[model samples]
Target: MSKDTDNSNLTADNSANTTSSPSNDRSANNVAPNEVTFALAQSHFLVGDISANADKMRQLAIQARDQGADVIVFPELALLGYPPQDLLLRPSLSGRIKSALSALSDIQDIVMIVGYPHVDHHGTFNSAAILHNGHQKGFYHKQFLPNYGVFDERRYFDKGRNQVLFDYKGITIGLLICEDLWEKSPIADLKQQGVDIIVSLNASPFETGKQDMRKTMLTQRSREHKVPIVYVNAVGGQDDLVFDGGSIVAQADGSIAHEAPRFLDQLMLATLNVDSNTFNTQEKAPLTLSRESEMYQALVVGLRDYVNHSGFGGVLVGLSGGIDSALTLCIAVDALGADKVYAVMMPYEFTSKISLEDAQAQARRLNVSYTVCPIFDAVEGIRHTLAPLFNKSPADTTEENIQARARGVILMALSNKFGHLVITTGNKSELAVGYSTLYGDMAGGFDVLKDVYKSQVYNLASYRNRLEDTPVIPERVITRPPSAELRPDQKDQDSLPDYEVLDGILTLYIDEDMGYQAIVDKGFDADMVAKTIKMVDNSEYKRRQSPIGTKISQRAFGRERRYPLVNKWSINS
Candidate 1:
C-alpha cells in the first residue's frame, strides 16, 4: 500500500497487526504508574540508503520497546536522511519509501514516529509517519518549508496546512518537523488544541553557538505553551554540513530533563508523568562544552563522516609546518586513526628549518606515517619549462605559485596512487582574498579549514595542544609569525592585512552581512575595509572551485553564501 494513500485514514491489516506481548519487566512501570516512556533515536542515517535506514529504525524500535518505551521518535527525514537534495526527485523514491515503511510496520506494541518524504497525487512533502503494530496509523506533513541559508526545502516539498495531533494512553501528543517549531503559529495552534506534549523531529545542521540557541528556544516555547517537549535531532556529517545531536527533553516549567551528548549517536529515554504533566529529570545531564571544545568536536565529526561515507580508505595531508596544516593533521588523526592518516611535507629552497622540524615533530608526536618530499627538483624543472615562454621576463608571484603547485602535484599523485583523500590546508582568510593558488594549494578533494579564519586557526591550535600532556602541535608552530615560505623571509601580511583586522572586517561584512560603509563606521579604517571587500569580491571564482569542507560558522562559503562570479555591483555602486 502507498504510505500516504490513506493519509487521513488509519486502519490496521488484521494479519499484519499481530503484536508480541509487552515485557513483564517493564522499565516504565518502575518509574510511575501514570507515566509514559519516550525513546529519542538520535542516529546517523546515510542519505539515499532507504533500506538500511529503515532496518536501523526497526532495530532501534525493538530495542526501545524491549526497554519499556511506549513511543519512539526519530530525527527529521530519518528514512531517506535529511537534506536528501535531488535524491527526493528520483522516480524510484516512492517505491523505496513504500518498501521502507512496510518493513517498519512490523514493529509491535510501541508507536514509531518516523520522518520521511510523503508523496501522492497532490505533491511531495517533508513528513512524519505514525506506525503502530501493522497499521500506518497516520502521518504529519511539515508545515514550514525553510528556504534560507543552507536550506531549500521549498524546492522539494509543498507546505502542509494542518496540525496533526493524536492520543495514546489518554495523553494528547502533537507532532512537528524541524522548521515548524521555529515559527510561533504551529506551537500556538498545538497549544490551542490542548496537546499535553510536543515531539519535534529535527535534522538541524550544526553551527558555532547553535546548541545554546536551541536550548533557549525550547525553554521559552515549553514554558509559554505549558507543554513538555521532546526534541530528537540527527547526528553526523553530510558533505559540508554537520548535525550535532544534542537532543533534549524540556519540562513544561522550562527545566531540562535530559540532554544528549553532542556529535554522537545516542538512544536517550525520558519519562513523562501524566498526572503532573512534567518530565522526570535524569540523574546526570551532559556538560555544556566551551566554544573551542564545541568547534573542535564539530570539525572532527565533520571530517570523520565525510571521509568514511565517501568510501576513502584513508586521508593524505600536505603538511607545510604552518598552523593550518598542523591543526588539520591533529583533526585528521583524531577523526581517522593515526594508522589511516599520512602526512607529507614538501619543502623547497625557501622552506625554513623551523618548519621542517615542526612538521616532522608533529607527525612523530601524532604517530602517523610521515614523509619529507623536497620539491627542489620538481620546481626547477617547471621553471626551466616556463623560461622559454617568459623570454627573460622578471619573476613575480608566478615562481611562488610553482612551488605550491609542486606540493599539490605530489599530494594528488600520492592520493591517486594509494586511494586516499587529499586534504587541503588553506584557511578562510586565505580563501577570502585569493591568497591561495588554484590547482596549486587548492587542488585537494577537501579543505578542512576552508570555513575557518586565520585567527580561529591559531586559537584552535592552542586549544588542541592543551588536550594532551605533551602538545601534539609544536608550540613554535603556533607562536611563530605565519608565512607561506614560498620566498625568503616572506610573511602573510606582506600581501594581506593583519589577521585580527581582516577577520574583524570579514565577520562584519560576511557573517553579519554589513555594508562596506557600515563596517568602516564601526571604528575600522575605511581604506582597509575597502581593500578587504575588493579582495573578497575578486576571489569568488577561486572559492567556487575550492573543495567542500566542514562549516562550523553561521556563514560558510559554498551553499550558505553565494555571489555572482561576474557581478558589476561593488562598494562604489
Candidate 2:
C-alpha cells in the first residue's frame, strides 16, 4: 500500500526518463515530481515452463519501454504461473528467477516489477522486485498468504514483513502482490506513510461475479485512504483456477476509470493526471459485461486454452442432450471453431427419443462434427460376461452403470487414438452426492461444468444459446427433467432431492460451510438434510477421483473441495 509521492522526492540517476517532459501524462509537482506510467502484463502461463515464462516478461519489458511505460508489473509468480505448489522445493528455481531479474536489468531503461518467490537469510518469501538496467531498485515480500479455500500459500511462502518503496521516474511506488491487498494492514500502512498510489499485482482465481467484488474493493480502498489504486490481475487457467485479468483503475473519489476485458489477454494502459489543482484519472473507454456473461466467458476461455494449450487439436463431448453437455458443447464451439469440436451422441435403450433428437439438432445447429455411437452391443457384451456369476437379481443401477461405462469406453478409446480432450458434463449436484459413476460418466480429460450446479446449468445453457444467433441447445433439454438414463424408467429425482431444492442446500452446506444442523435449521426438511449430508460425506472419494474441473465458484472440486475420504463423523448424530 505505497501511497503519496514517495518516488517524486528521490534524486535522479541522470537518465532521460528521470528528467521532466512537457508532454508527460501526469505533472511532476508532488514530492516525487517525476512522471511515471506502468503496464500490467499477463499471459497464458504454462506450468513449469520457467525459461519461456521469463522470456515472455523480458519481451514485455521491452514492449512496455517502447510504449512509454516507466515501469511494468506482471502477475503473481509470473515466472511459473499460479500455485506452483511444491515445485518451489526445486532449490534452483529461486536462482533462475534472480538471474531472470538480472537479465531484465541489462536490457532497458524502465523499472520492471515481476512477481516470484525469493529465498533469503530471513526466510522464503513471495516477492516482487523493482529493477532497471540490471540493478535492484526495491523488493517487497507478499505479507498476507491466504490459506483458505484453493489457496495454500502459507505452506509454500514465509510471510513478508517490510513494505519496500522505490523511486521510479521521479514517482514513489509501493508494491503488494495478490493476497496482500485483500487485508487491511498493507494499505493502512501506505496511507499512514502518505505515498502516492498503490499498485497491486495479483493472480486471483475466477469465481462468479468476482469482477464486481474487485471494483468494490479497489474503489472503496481508494476512497477510504484518499489514494488511487491500480489492480493488475493474472489471466488464463492453471489446473482448476482461472484468472479473469480484469485489471482495473479506481481513483480517490471512488470512481473507476478503466477496466480490462475478462478471461482474455490484453494490455491495459491507464494514465492518471495528478497535481495540487486536481487528482483526476484520464478516462479510457470502459469495457462492460454482465455478471452472467462474464462467468460464461471465463468458462469458454478456460476450456479453449486448456484444450489447445495442452496440445489437443480439438475436443470431444458426450452429448446426452442434457443442459450440462449442451452448454459445454456451445462453449467448446465458441472457444475453438466449430471445426475443432466433435459431439458424440451415445444413446442407449433407456435414452428417450427426444434426447436423441435434441442431441442431433444441437450438433447441426453448432455445425460441429457429430456421430451416433450406440452402446447396445458393448453393454450387452459386458452384461453377458457378468451373467456367469449367478446373476439372478433384477436389473438395477449396476446394469445402468454398464451403459454409461460403455459410452465412456468409446469416448476414451477415441481420446487415446485421436488425441482429443474429452470434456465431462456432470454438474456439481451429481458430483456432490455420488450421483456420477467413477469410471463410467466421470471418465474424461476435463470437466467443464463440474463447479456449476445443476440448477445453474439450465440457466447457463439457455443464456449461452440466447447469446448466439440460434438455439443450439434444444428446448426439450431446458424444459425436461434431468435423468442419468441408466434404467428404463430411472430419473435423477429417484435418488436425490429435486435440483432446485438440492442445489440450494448444497450452496449452504458446501460454499457457506454450514454444518448439518445449521442447514436443517434453515427450514429444509430435517430428514432430507440428514440424508443429503450423508450422501455428500460419502461422495468425497468419488470427487477426489473426478477430473480436475475449472473452479467457477468459491468451493469447487480438486483443490478447493477437500474432505477426508475415510471420515466417519455425522452431524445429525
> Best by TM-score, which number?
1
Estimate candidate 1's alpha-carbon lDDT, on a 0 to 1 scale: 0.89
- Which runs of model 1 end up more than 4 angstroms from their true locations? 1-33
lDDT of each: 0.89, 0.78
The C-alpha RMSD of each candidate to the native structure, in angstroms, is 4.3, 4.3
**Could you give candidate 2's per-residue lDDT for residues 1-573 as a string of tens digits?**
222244433322211123221222323223234345667785666767877887888888788767766668888888777779989878787787777666666765666777877887777888876665555655778889999988898888888777656544434556788788878889888667655678888888899878888888888888888877778889997777788888877777778876777777776656555453123354565467776687788788788778877899988999988777889898889889999999999988888998888899999998999999899999999999999784587877788788889999999999999989998988899999899988888999889888889888887877876876767788888888878877777778988889999998999999999998898889999889888888899899888888878888987878876778886688846
Per-candidate TM equals 0.95, 0.92
Give the C-alpha miss distance for residue 385 in model 1, angstroms: 0.9
lDDT of 1 by residue, 1-573 (tens): 212122222232111131222222333335455777899999999999999999999999999988878889999999999889999999999999999999877677778999999998869999888887676767888999999999999899988888877666557788899889989999999888677889999999999999999999999999998899999999999999999999999999888899999999999999888778888888988888999999999999999999999999999999899999999999999999999999999999899999999999999999999998999999999999999999999989999999999988999999999999999999999999899999999999988998899999999999999998999999999988999999899999998889999999999998889999999899999999999999999999999999999999989999999999998998988
Off by over 4 Å in 2: 1-34, 277-285
